[model samples]
Target: MNDHDNNLPAVPEGDEPVPNPGLPPHHWRPTDVDPKAEKRAERQVAAFFGVATVALLGFFVSYFAFQVGDNWDTIAGLGASNLMLGLTLAIAFLCIGIGLIHWARKLMTDQEIVELRHPAASSEEDRSTSVGLVLQGVDDSGIGRRPLVRNSLLGALGLVGLAPIIMLRDLGPLPGDKLLHTIWKPGMRVVRDVVGTPIHVSDLEIGDLVNAEPAAIFELDDEGHHVVEGVELQIAKSKGAVILLRMEPGEITPWKGRENWSVEGIVCFSKICTHVGCPISLNERTKHHLLCPCHQSTFDLADNGKVIFGPAARHLPQLPIEVDDEGYLVAQSDFTEPVGPSFWERDKT
Candidate 1:
């Protein structure tokens, strides 16, 4: 009935007319309109990539320069080694991201395109054409022809691979015979951890649990002692730490061949969980259950640290204990069997 109705496209009696909105005006970028600006942008992107290469090289240098245990006070509580390593590696990744963005915005072709709707499945001809387009893009990247860019990218990637290799240091040296031994020895006094004082039977009470370690494990001889320092100390302590729990004498049920392993009602078991080597000490005195916080593996302290519940595949290894003439508790000997989680080499024979 009006100019608007006359201009609108014809529609079916009950169908709605489609709305029309023209595309927005295009605005050309500085690099797109100027050749010199384009070249400058390309160089700026390349410079960013160059800086990224240097940062990656610095990452490798920091990896080897700083020891894991070095003092951290040098950088406002951040270790010098960690600070440099993190900064260099972070810059390396950040530069690459920024460089790629700059290259896309300034150097790569930018044009608006409109594609009509098509079926989800592509025709064989369309597929072949798409493959050709991908190949053409790869060729345009000049990765094979530009030795400087190609080599730098390759070198950066190679340095990145070193991160996982360096982390492998945490897996540690093959445990070997180390897992089979500890600081425990004949007549070595059992001492409370931290305070390093020898434990007497009188120091414990019924329903009491005390976390203890071998006195010799923490002792320094006149010329200083051997074993249990650095990585070795951490590994040894992980497998050697024990919990001493005292129950009512009538409540104790000793394992066979372990009748004399306890001093009075005081019994000792590995603090390391049997499930996956978590240091377990949570005690339920009324139930005689020692719970591992990691996986909730429960062991019965009254019944030789046997796995009573949860995912533990084996029992907590028990240490033999006795009172010496000096009235302090001491190990009769080192653990008769391996402690902590079971290993592939464990009990193989």
Candidate 2:
């Protein structure tokens, strides 16, 4: 019916004629047409892989060279260990990606192929053909022909995996008996947490709850002694923290042998919830119940910190307390039991 229709393929009487658009002419890249350009592209790809190798080497150097929190090992106010590790690892991955792209675009075959649609399941002969095609693709990638690219890429991959293994050192020397102890010891004064002022049993009223810590955090000997500093101080405070509450002595139902653990009506227990180690300060003062915010695990302070509700497997650990000659509350000794979340190796014995 028209000039466009004249180029259409013929059809049977019942079927409509369909247009046949011939494939466009394939355009060749500069590397395809010129031997010199092809050689330059291959060298460029090799150089990218070489850079990847160098970046990976830098990563290992940075790992051992920079100590965490070292003042001299900071760049732009961020830790050099973190900054260098991130940059080098990113460059190592980026170089490999860029090199692969350059190799595919410049040197690898770019011919148009037609793959007809077929059923999902293939015959045994088709599977064999697929394996042969995979080998053919590997050969076409020039990895066998190019020793430099292959070796450098392999080296980069092998070394990059070592970065994580080196970081295992940060897990620190095995815990040993360190986790079983804290800054709490005999005669350590109980002080308010943030202000670090010594607390007296007479200072608290009935139904009063105060978050407190060890007095070693605030005191200095004749020569300005330091009990704990930096990370050690933080770890000590976290494990040694306590909540001091004043309730009617008649309301308290002390456990066996713990009858003398409290001073007057004032009692102290660990602030860390036995359920997942959440900080619990929420108090039901009238009922003498301590509620953990994380899991709603409730402990009865009146009954030796017994688990009254929720999913906690252990009761809140109580600290032994006695008033010093100065009338200030002090620990009789360290916690008789471990505090915080329970572990498999914890003293079930």
Candidate 3:
């Protein structure tokens, strides 16, 4: 570490700047020597752009083929939609960059030139010279002579620009008050999720947890077909899902003015987590704690759905429930507060 001398020779300082060292010797690429090699390089660059085009097409296919939740396939715990979209978009952009770099290094002008330093501001003559140099550079690029590379680049760029424009359809006319409310309303019966069978308070036993959804989700048309289908059905189910849990009445601590919210010992809370909206029902019966498998957020079902532990910042939303005239458990009204993770207009409600 101490082998080098600490003191070094110092040169005299002057007002005049150091003389220019000049440019290094230019090295010609293989593409510059043989016409066959030049043609091969050109084709290679175009092939990269071609691959980019194919990747963009695959992105579009993945967008349409794979629905977000129920219809999506999975790869290593990641949804195929997410995986394909990210992979394709990354490849598209990467290929474009590689193609441009390869074109510059192998085909574009390689001569070395040195320019003396000049004032920051340019005169009219200097500006004209700069414009001429830019035009000369374009000519030296051979873009006009090589129609294959030029057209391929233009096509790839056009598709790249078109991809985002296609996705702009997701920005709707606006959500209005749609997201502020769910399918749940006063007197709406709480039913099991997939089977859509109405649940009675007597059906639940102590320490039982049942996944449920709003009865409106099963409304039949004149032909006995479900009225809520496709994307609308998915949205309604996501926003209206709840869990019916039965614990000892004495074990529950009702929040202010919420004493009548539960039917006997059966209390209802939104299944969606407050942290990031993952469905949560991993129950600890002894402590009445509901844990989210996604992020380990925990909530206490016996105490107004309070966040008892983990990453959840807010309590799980409680759904007020009462027994119907027919002995079925039904909602008293829509949730007093919006459920699920926080959103931009969540506080507005």
Candidate 4:
């Protein structure tokens, strides 16, 4: 009826005509209209990719340059190895993301397109059309024509994948027989933990539990320095730890061939729980039960360290003991079986 309505497309009888609003006017960007601006933008995107490449190189350098706990490798109160690896890797990933964004925004094809709606289901024609569109998209991305940006992006991604592969070397050279044996050997004197004082049978009372370790832990060399120190000392102490419990001699139910393993009424067993290798010391003196605090795995020291309750599948390993000439308790031999939690090769023998 009015001037605006007159421009509308004609419709069938008795049907209302729908107004059509066309797309907005197109505005050309600086890079789209000018050659120099396009070149500058391309350089900027390439520079971002270059920075990403440099950051990735730095990541490799940092990975091998510093050890985890080096005394001199501290930065901002954090370990230099961790700090540099995190910082460099973060910068490399950030730069790669930014470079891709800049490339898409500044250099990729800029246009407004309208596509007619079609059926949701696919057919032979739709599949062919989709393949054509994918090829067109690849061409529009200009990756083939932009060698500088493409190569740098490919290099960064390749390096990122390679970094993880290099770290797989730390998985191990295999523990071999290390877990099968410990620092405890024949005639190793059982001393009180922490204080490192030798223990005599008279020093213990009935129903008493004392945490003890092997005497090799406190042995001094000719220079007066501990023979077992550093990481070796820590590993030895962990695997060689035991608890000496004194109960009435008649109360103990010794297993076959273990009647002489205890001295008088005191018995020794590995402190590590067999379920998950947690250190256990909570003792129920009334019942002679040793309870692991971590998961409630209980062991009865009076009955040859039998598993009385909880999730422990195996009984605690006992250390055969006898009194030395000086009355100090000593191990007759190392543990007959391996101590600690279950492992893959544990049941092989």
Q: For candidate 2, write residues 1-349 as lDDT tens digits.
A: 9545789655657543444455688999999999999889888988888888899889889988987753558889988998999999999999989988999999887787755566799999999999999999999888898787788778878887887887797888788877677678889999999898999878999999999998765435688876668787877887899999999888888978999999889999999998799999999989999999998999999998999899998888899999899999999998988888888778642
| Candidate lDDT values, in order | 0.79, 0.87, 0.88, 0.87
Q: Report the number of the highest-lDDT candidate.
A: 3
Error of 3 at 119 (Å): 19
TM-score-based ranking: 2, 4, 1, 3
lDDT of 4 at 33: 93
Which digits, one per residue and each the tens of the lDDT, describe model 4 over residues 210-281?
Answer: 999998855556888567788988789889899999999999999889999999999999999999999999
lDDT, model 4, position 227? 71
Better of 3 and 4 by TM-score: 4
lDDT by residue for model 3 over 1-349, one digit each (tens)? 3324656544457433556787787778899999999999999999999999999999889888877756668888889888998999999999999999999999998898876678999999999999999999999999999999999998888889989986885676567777667888888999998998999888999999999999874565687966777898888887999999999999889998999999889999999998889999899988889999998998989989998788877898899999989999999999988888978656622
Ten consecutive residues with minimal summed lDDT in candidate 3? 1-10
Candidate 1, overall lDDT? 0.79
TM-score computed on alpha carbons, candidate 3: 0.52
- For model 1, what is the alpha-carbon lDDT of residue 228? 52
What is candidate 1's TM-score against the reference?
0.56
Q: Which of the two, 1 or 2, has more TM-score?
A: 2
Separately for all candidates shown, the number of backbone clashes (residues 3 or more apart, or on different chains) is: 0, 0, 0, 0
The residue ranges of model 2 lying beyond 4 angstroms of the native Cα positions read 1-48, 66-70, 73-95, 105-111, 115-151, 162-181, 192-197, 201-210, 218-224, 227-239, 246-260, 276-278, 282-287, 336-338, 341-349
What are the RMSD figures for all models against the true structure? 7.5, 6.3, 11.0, 7.0
lDDT of 3 at 283: 94
